[model samples]
Target: MSYRRTTDFLLHDWLEVSSLQSRARFADHNRETFDAVLDMCEKLAAEKFAPFNRLADTEEPWFDGEKVHLPAASHAAAKAYAESGMLAAAQDYELGGMQLPCVVEMAANSFFSKAGIGIGGGGMLTSGNANLLMAHGTPLQQQVFAANEFGGRFSGTMCLSEPQAGSSLSDVVTRAVPDGADFEAEPLGPRYRLRGNKMWISNGEHELTENIIHLVLAKIPGPDGKLVPGTRGISLFIVPKKLVGTDGQLTGERNDVALAGLNHKLGYRGIPNTLLNFGEGKFPVRGSAGAIGYLVGKSGEGLRCMFHMMNEARIAVGLGATMLGYAGYEASLAYAKDRPQGRPMGPSGKDATLPQIPIIRHADVKRMLLAQKSYCEGALALELYCARLVDEAHTGAPDDAAQAALLLEMLTPIAKSWPSEWCLEANSLAIQVHGGYGYTRDFPVEQYWRDNRLNMIHEGTHGIQALDLLGRKVVMDGGKGLQLLASRINATIERALALPDFAEQGNTLAATLAQVGAATKAAWATGNPEEALANATPYLQAFGHLVLGWIWLDVALCAQARAATLDHALLQGKLAACRFFFRHELPRVGAWLQVVTRRDDTCRTMDEAWF
Candidate 1:
């Protein structure tokens, strides 16, 4: 088995994750269940998904004017994924789900992502869409739209971005007007005529599923028939590709949701990214002028409702980036071990018969491998940590749940952005490890790099996440979330101090935490919010490193406690990675924090005309 697929570190880290879930009332999720789910995912990913990863990239989906055509393997893999009952892994059992913990679902998801992100993206998007409906949709809405999605009979999408609006929801111009008595009303809600264009809609016009349920964000005109400004007036609607009757059966009447065109991507080519004309005259719905849709939550609460999926998608994006890095690392490691090339630097005489050693023996090659290991493994840990926190937020005691929510709020941006930035670096290192061959399609590292590159910009751009981290998350509600995070880190520090093997690691992390706190204070002390946030990106990087450092120390302590019983190499690897991160990666936080705390505005203050 590839090291990426069956890393002991995954089971090691999952120990803590499972423990947290058990304490939060998830009693059925022991190691047996977790490992079973993981094993299933691993097998399915390798057999059904990984074989077609390269194929999917090479044979990108095509639009033949009307329909998007993808490889048969894409649909097959998606059906297998949905049939595994993982689509609703965390949903309630009564809702036709497995009721698995979110962390376990995340771990299982990593395998699919490692196999192929383009294929995994369909499952992730469907899961996110279903989760959102479960969270905020009415019972009828959940039964009609989300249930079929969970059952694999249908697929779902979140449609937010527009050509003009992009990430700025305030500028969205999609309008949803009440359809009146013309359209049939169901138990879900009143129907509306949705007329707008949704750009970058994944799974927008695919034949893989029977129906496509789009969670679209649009604004309803007020009493004056004028749309409200900004996200305040935006509303979420359930727009189906095919009209469904109140009985959840197809009406054979196609909705006015027409396919505008296909947007081919550099990577993630298996899933069709599209521009959808929701209510153009191309397809009329019952002689109606616009697409038929049902409002989701309140009229003006669209952003809030969409946020459920957005946040989930952000974390999923982070996981996608992490898995891509892991895939590259595994591929490079295998190549390094098997491919014989250079001899030792000192002993390589000009003898024509000298035996060439494997590249893994080289110090520089080891350095690159270690870098990838630390980055991919650390990112995986960070994402799982966030997933466990999500479980805590949802299922823990009152105060614990509140604190967990606060801490998750503070860490979400870091969890999303940090892995994206570092894991891409890991993929680069993997490419470097393979040298020339890595750049070519003969190996998978280059494709891994390409696929991961999209993650940095999707969900929310790194810059957007950084602004949220430094400008909003850390400072909101008088920094209660930040304080809660500090308290949790301090608790870990205290626990680590009691263990002799981890005292130094804990102390180093403690010092870094203190530096982060001080830097945050100094940055905000300027009282000029704009100036303080000028170098928010650097602050985000520094803060993200601090969070990773804390998580590493926490994991190290846990590993140390289990060292006697666990595999020796696994334990040593965790400790060594922790040390490597602290010695090499953590110190960079100091320099970044300096730029942050000093309120460096050289870049921000630069005149645009100068460029």
Candidate 2:
């Protein structure tokens, strides 16, 4: 199915996102306006982004001593996206935003993600950066920094990872010191001088926009002049590439931030990823060595503020992974229908005179195609459902909003990690469907696979997400989040039980849910972190399958409701994918949960010396 058709079904038919018009935040939008937005984005993505997906991949960004050079197509795509007014799609009207529902905005952006994520630029990071400042920065900071970022004159990057500290935030050694005795009097906020090196920073250095807004994390020294240890001392800083005046105009002087080098990557090469040096005396301001930065929020709350962007990025990453898988699935499906292969055996035992049939006619080929459909479509539904929850958390009535937030917290890790794992598998199957042709770069499926492989490690690694799900998200708030999630799942189960066609799948899902709950209890039975998290990955896998099962079943109910009016083939296709997932995919949850329930430590305790 086309991206537009899929999104239309999810937004209007399944989620009924148009109902959001009743909310104050989206009061101005109706189905027409929403369709207009999606149509514009779809056209622009096809025109500017799709044609250059391969160009962006083949002609990777290169540095030329003073600046980085990307394909002109990449630059054009970025400019078009900026002009599309989607960066602030969810912001208020006064802020030059459409004030559309979050679900609608997410659906619109899916077009660009599927077209070419690399060429799509850093709009996600820039929007997330502006969103963070709007939430945490002073009013002046918002006007000067966030406003310009939303306007597309400034791009953004979140500088978190360092060469030594990777994902371990507590080990970060970047330091920020007071700029002067009167630093507190600075107009922007508390002024500081940051000196550190940030690694693997995407869009870290680019000329696509007038400036780059970097939200850097660094340590502030204590009274004794020694840096405080752990994340407790970490703080956020607004370190613009070019110093800006009170009027939000560039000061014409460079800040101390410098691009040390670019890290050549395997995929996503269209966007520059760099090692940045702050306050390294490379471009000293006011005859000083340190990079001037304005502090954001209070001290020691950097991670809290940064999580706002991180969580948003995680969901966006999941969407990107899903679209890439969808792209591959469509490609392989098209290929299967056109490529004639071996003929089916006849009762006569020989059919040399008969023409070869399309590969799609083969049972094994159908199995592979069905797997891809189940994974990609189910993941798409899951992401969109999460997006709908974002809308509810922001705009629903008080009690409902609170419940939405709790459910979102419980599902965020799964939303991010599950698609990253399974969609990449879908991409592999897509390539497999193409036979030998899929392995070559000539086909898009291979690149789709390469690009998707990065999602597993993008926002957070699979292991990190697993730990978050089992260690923190499930157990936090006296397990309220998990309980809220269970309630939502059981409600769907009850609905399915009322239908004879879905009653069996409902029972299977209930059993799986119970097994997951038991595993969760068994994992933490001893209250030991090491023991509980020993098989966290397996636990994550099982939990993710359970969530997908719930999502597919829920989606099937929607499709079934429209079966009388919807296109016969489309409705049947949806039902088939749902059945495929329950019969072929959901059973794997049992094996995964078995390992988790037993707190398997075979891999954890194995000595390196054993090798």
Candidate 3:
């Protein structure tokens, strides 16, 4: 099957993206420069990342009871990416970065993801890690670790999940004690010794860089000499793989971070997912009992500091899933167009003498292809919209920034979970489109599906995100965020109404929006938190569908406005996708909203024994 990059949609339908760059004060990056960056990314990914994608999957990382070893091609691809300077593409020039807008950076990164998500993950983690430090790290910490990370001399990881504490960060038992007296004074500030084991750490241990900067979450004891309970006591720390001195040079002494083992997975096997032991006594640290580290921010504010990286990561995960689904869609579309199969339904025997037509001529195949196109492309719009919101929150006018923040907060959970859910469905349909061959490893769709399955669980599970959306975000600040989002969607609906071709879609979305608002109130009317949130997942689904409906209408309006200027086929494709979503996909919102609006409790009220 022929491969394709979905970034084409960004250029054709999302012309407003350039305005975002201008708003962010990216004066040097006009449309030409932006396209140049994307072109370079496509070339690099096709050459360095794509060739090794299947090899990395087949030869997964392994531990030799001493060190972790990955394919040499993995290192070559990572080095190529780092040397390309894309890792710090969004950072300031003073920080040795390209100073591109966040939206442009995300657009460029999507190319790598389409080539391979596992390789793409390393860059995402490093970029997020560097961005966090740049935001909250002390001056010296930023100069040393963050600089190295941005320069690609070092990579980074976020250690949050422990064997004992997966998502329940409140139960984390990692301990950090002041040990500044033992270590010489350094530019990174006060030091401590971190002791605990971190599980499911991606890029935890590798030779991809000179060193790994670990942003660890642990607790520092109070006067009672006992660690405080829950997230309130947690603090962030910078733990490195090898100790560094005040001169920004390696001390030649390995830190107390050891790899306990490797967790082999079904997909995204390019980078090593590890079980890491910190200060486990398997490795000694200057006669110390734990890993030496420096504080990131104030004590008891670890979760707050970590949120900087987590939020960035959440959106990146959504983009990753979107690209994977898109890759599969492209592959399937190519296959459907080229592979001829059974005759059309009119008359089989009469056409036996005639050439067999491609599967794309069949109505069902078109249905599946259209479904894939809508879901994947709609997801692309949602993620790029979120990225633009990030840019607006940082650099827009004061009122615009405030409004952007509110909308971002309200839609972030949807950004993470909606794409994860629907894009995975796109991958499934892509597999089905390939028939028997798609189920086998010989084709890429199976791998795409396996890789996408992890996105639903990464950053946060679907259920966790659902609770966050329905139980917290929708109600925060007297529902100001939801109101802001509603205003934006309403504006789109109003604009779409002006176009005669989209008046019906606008009406459909407007009705869905009203239903969603009604359901939101109905779901929370009981006043009992448990009773009100019993069906949060369905509410999330309904809310997600509504958001997609709004986004598709917005996209159709954009296409309709450019109908005369854009390619005839491209414009038609966008219009067709918008119609498919409204006609076939948006109606499902009504069913989901009915459950939310009525506060359905079929599962909530069921007895445990019924299972």
Candidate 4:
């Protein structure tokens, strides 16, 4: 019942998603089934997920030549999860899951991820692949392959990055050729016999489950030789770790994918990061390959199909970042209240005689805690907002879904990167709160730092996200993304202005957004699209704040609405967090705006000649 109050405040005041009292509440679009799923998620997260977090971090998974090792605690926890029939939470119930709404899955993920990311990562990847195959795979493909994953009998991966092609998919040299015998003039589908190397694949060598399903991307040679351009000529294949019979059961022929090496990463060690070799032998129908691969979609459409998985993964990365940061903040808050350390700076004999006060009593400690709370909570809100948008895009009636898609696309990079950046700040503050102990493995904050650091790199490095935001999303469909986002933010400001205690912040946000709009317009006209887009990261960040500020304000409105009916402090806590974010975080925009407008030559000036 100790950390219970804070957790309760987070769920109830900010994200209950069930309450209908607030006009600004997200519940209108949320269905009853969604609420039930969300409640279940929070229940298990607090009960089952959070408990084994430290153990997973302590007992990171390992690997031998044959199988990657995992902790027993993870097995128990995953079993609990699997038994709950929640593995395919986002899938159709017909696919063997509870069919939870995406937003709720994200919220529940907040708990599970906060508890343990390493183990949670496996579940997420499996879910993503199940979703991907359901969307693109044939009926037989779904029955044979994705079914086991959705059923929790297997796990899946999106294998795109090789040691050679980390971010640039165009540079992929992993080759695919025909595999089946009596091949026609040209065989279509995921069965072209894939061969190539895939590196940094999560769950690559794990024995956590019996089978590993890899949605692999590779290049196949044209009759003339040489490579193709763009994302064309790249294809995705459902390449199993071992070849299987067409009858949906396992066979013993090793496909091309083999782990060449495993990376001892700075974080997220529970899932093995692997380098895989593919297509080594001659196929019955066609050419020699170091490993076997079966194509996913038509040839030259691998990146497109992979995009489906990447988009989801991007959101997952954001959620992971949010959860880790939130957990660290929660831990710090607990320590601040319970770990009594110091007296007032100017203390009398009476003060000195007093028992050491909780660190929360100190001004500096409050500052740290407030900062941590703001980022962690705001990041979670941003992530949840995106999740809700996804829900809207799918479930909401007509007009709403279009708006949701636009706003969601605009915020994706910010959603992916801001949490990565700010959550790291939260973890840093957590360490500071723990003093020297945080630096040691004795406390999990240090591990939190290590784990959180990878997020900034993994899904798309912050820089890549920035470039995407600026270069593409901003320009995409002639600035529809930014304009759509502006429309929603404007609407939020308008609504909040009509409410009390929020009018001032609403005006402040409105003005800040206007400034952002001005900057965005200026960048749009800046002649150099690349240069303008170079500033996309900062633009994305500014846009994220506006969006998050809107969310916080909405939460404040919800809090006020609930205050009249519920008489609970949850709403009050939400208001306080909202006020803190607006006051403390929003004003920093002046500096970033200056960068976006003034065009700092820092990165541009760092020349090869200077080195």
Candidate 5:
């Protein structure tokens, strides 16, 4: 099957560092490297990753006695990714990677993950590991560990979750005791031993790599004989799969950590999520009954040090969620156009002799298509926007960048969870578009649904996202974060309001902004935030709906404005999508707003015993 997409599908003509301020006469930045990165991704994805998606799912990674056994195709895909220089795209150039823009990387990452999140896991972990190493590891530490030790043969895992502490890291029972081993330890790295277990670790125990570098989060006893509750008491360490010699190669000496069990998951099955016992039988190879841990930043500043990597991972999570939705939308749209189906609803007026039509011809089907298109496309726009913010955050625009970051922080949960929730719904509707046939195993849609279900549970749950939105982000820096977001969207609407067709949409968006602003004030008015937590989820959804609407309008306005210079008619489909969403979807915001303003007894009125 040929998976051909037109350039019309994408918002921009090609990858470029566009002046966000420049509406006309756009120039592509030094995208030679970016184009090379894109070419590498396209080549590897089509030639290797895409073909192995179904195969990987069919032969889901397995745990034998010692190592996790991934299919040969999966391993080959990983190798291809590494060789193509795409595995470490986010790393610094000196770190042996094709340093590319985060936005461009994200665009390519969409293709890779869409091929299979299962196959994409290894590369994701590699990038994450490289990030951790880059941020926390010292110069000598980088030389011995990142450069020489693991080198290309090593893999990394962010071992944070435990049975008792999933999101609540402060509650982790993982302990790191001081070591008096004969082995020479780094001055900058953690010079102790770790004795604890971490659960839900992806790629925890796999033979695909020569060694695994476990970034264990642990708490050592303080002077008062107790580990603190805050992040200060926590520490990060690089516990290797095998002890390395001065030359940076492994000594073939096994570390204390052992794979307890493999976690069977719904999707991303190619990467093994393992339950690990850090110090088990024959443990503490270099230390006394505890696994040796080379410290990261400071003794107690582990959480602070890890934040750099975690924030990067958060963007990755959002990016993953966005693209999976995009993939489903693209696939479903193609199917609608390609698949021949029933005729028009009209009274067979002109020609009853005519054959059946594609599903795109139907108004209701078009509604579903448009819904998916808008949701996924808005999500793409948001992710790219956030990526641009990240670029600015790194470059010259510090204050604006910081404010942009604050806005992203406020919206991150929504970015991650909204796509997971809304786009999974998109996948469901894709199945519906396929009719009963979609539910069957014959099509990929069912698998797509199964795969998408995990996205809600990944990085963090949807409820967690809602809480993140309402509980913390809303009031951060005296609500300046939210105001910053409002200003950005309002600015877009201001530009769009100049257009003829967008005047009504501009008004609708204005109304939504007002509603959201008011609801935010009401949310703040409650005396106790916990008591007011009932309004959290609805507020999240209400605000999410509005953000999406704003972004969609941005896209429509762009298309309208750019039409004169370019083949504006080519943007007909995107314009239709914007109009369809405004006409069909925007009206529902009022009801959602009612839900927000009323703040009803849905969670109230019912007793706990009723459950």
Candidate 6:
């Protein structure tokens, strides 16, 4: 299916996103406006992004002595995406935003991600940074920093991981000190001097925009002149690449921030990933050795503020992974239909005179294609469903909104990690469908696979997400989030139970859900973090499969409802994918859950010298 058709079905038919118009926030938009937005983005992505995807990959960004150089196509793609007005698509009208629903915005952006995720530029990070500032920054900070970022004049990066810290934010040693005695009197916000090195920062240094906003996380020293330990001492600082005045104009003077070096990556090579040095005296401000930064939010609340962007980025990463997988699926499917291969088995004897059939006619080929379909399409549905929940959490009635928020918290890790894992698997299968050609760079599927390999480590690694799911998200708020998720899944189960065609799947899903609940209880019954989280990744995998199963089943119900009017092939295709997932995919949940439920410690308890 075409990207447009898939998005149209998800937005209008399945999710009924147009119903969002009844909400006061989306009152100005109808199906026409939404379609227009999608149409524009689709056209722009095809013209500017798709054609250069390979160019971006082949001609990776390189650094000259003074600046970074990306393919000319990368610059054009970034400009087109910025001019498309999607960076602030869900923001208020006063912010130069379309005020589109979050679901619609997500659907629209999928086109770009599918076309070329790396060349999609820093728009996601920019919007996410602006969103964080709007939520946590002072009014002046929002006007000066967030506004410009939304306007596309400034790009953004979240500087979290350091060379030593990696994912352990508590171990971060980056320090921020008061700029002067009168630092609190600074107009933009409390002023500080930050000195540290940040590693693996994407879009950390680029000339695509007028300025780059670095939201650096560092620790403030205590009264005794020693840095406070753990995350409690951490604080967020708005460290712009260049000094900016309170009026939002560049001061024509560089800040102390400097790009130390770039990391040559395996894929997503179009965007520069850099090691940044802050307050390294590269370009000192006012004769000071430290990088000047403005505090955002209160001290000791940096992680809380940064999570706003981190969570958003996690979902966006999932969408990126999903779209890449989808692109591979479509490419392989097209190849299968056109490439003639060995003939099918016959009852009597081989007929040499018969023409070779399309590879898609082979049972094994269909199995591989079906697996990709079940993965990528279902992942697309899952991401959009989460996007819909974002809308609900933001705009729904009070009680409903609260419920949506709880459900979102529980699903966030799964939403990020599941697609990152399974969609990459889908890409592998797509390459497999292409036979030997798939393994070569001659085909795009290999690049798709390479690009997707990063998603498992992006945002948060699979292990971190697993620990977060089992250790924190499920158990937080007296388990209210998990309970809310269960309620939502069960609601779908109740609906499916009434239909004879879906009853078996519904029962299977119910059993899987029960198993998940049991595993959660069994894993945590001892109240030991080590024991409970020992097999957290397995727990995550099992729980994610259960969630995807629910998503596919729910989507199948929608397809069944439109059976009379929807195309026969499309309806069958949806139902078939759902069936394929339940029969072929969902059963794997049991093996994964076994380790979680039993708290297996084979790997966890292994000796350090075992290797």
TM-score of each predicted structure versus truth = 0.96, 0.99, 0.97, 0.91, 0.91, 0.99
By summed lDDT, the worst window of 10 consecutive residues in model 1 runs over: 1-10
| Alpha-carbon RMSD to native, per candidate | 2.1, 0.9, 1.9, 3.7, 3.5, 0.9
- Clash counts per candidate, in order, are 0, 0, 0, 19, 3, 1
Q: Candidate 3 residues 1-611, lDDT tens each?
A: 12223355554356466665555468767777888888899899999988878888888988777778888888889999999999889888887788787888888898899998877689999989988998999888888888889999989999999998899999889999888664436568668898999999999998889899999999998899898988999999999999987666798999999998889897898889998989887778888679988989788999999999999899999989998999899999999999899886664444667788999998899999999999988898888889988888999899999998889888899999998999999999999999999999888999999989999998999999999998999999999988989999999988988878788998999999898899889988887777778888888898998999888888778777777876777778878999999999988888887777778888789999999
In candidate 1, the residue pairs with backbone N, CA or C atoms under 3 Å apart (3 or more residues apart, or in different chains) clash, namely none
lDDT of 2 by residue, 224-273 (tens): 98888889999999999999998999999899999999988777777899
Clashes of 2: 0
lDDT string, candidate 1, 1-611, tens digits: 34543244554444455575456346767767877888899999999999999989999889787778889999899889988999988887887877777877898888899998888688888888988988888888888888899988889998999999899989999999889874446466768999989999888888899999999999999999999987799999999999887778899989999888888788888888989988886789888679988888888999999999999888888988989999998899999999898766566554546798899998888888887888888888888878877887888889988887888889889888988999999999999989999989999999999998988888999989988998899999999989989998999999988988778878888999999999999988969989888889989999999998888887777777777776787778778888888888998988999888888889888999999
Provide the overall lDDT of each model, using Cα atoms, as 2-decimal numbers.
0.86, 0.92, 0.87, 0.75, 0.73, 0.92
In candidate 5, stretches whose alpha carbon ends up further than 4 angstroms from where it belongs are 1-29, 148-151, 181-188, 230-232, 282-284, 348-354, 565-570, 598-605
Question: How would you encode candidate 4's per-residue C-alpha lDDT over 1-611 as one tens digit per residue?
Answer: 22344444445556664442232324333445554665676787777666777677667666576666778777766666766666777666577765455666777666678877876778888888878888888776787778888777778888888777789888898777665564333222435665567778887777667688888888878887666765788888887776666676777565655667777888886667887776645332223455555666677887888888888889889889988888788778877888888776664433667678888898888888878877877777778778868877876668988888887888888888988998999999999998988899887888888889999998789889878876788778988887777787788788888877688899989988887877777775667775576666777677667767877777677667767754465556667778888888888776676767765556666889888
- What C-alpha lDDT, on a 0 to 100 scale, does residue 522 get in candidate 5? 66
Superposed Cα deviation of residue 29, candidate 5 (Å): 6.1
- Winner on lDDT between 1 and 2 is 2
Ranking by lDDT: 6, 2, 3, 1, 4, 5
Task: Between candidates 2 and 3, name the one with more favorable TM-score.
Answer: 2
Winner of 1 and 3 under lDDT:
3
Error of model 5, residue 52, in angstroms: 1.0
In model 5, the clashing pairs are 189-295, 190-294, 190-295
lDDT of 1: 0.86
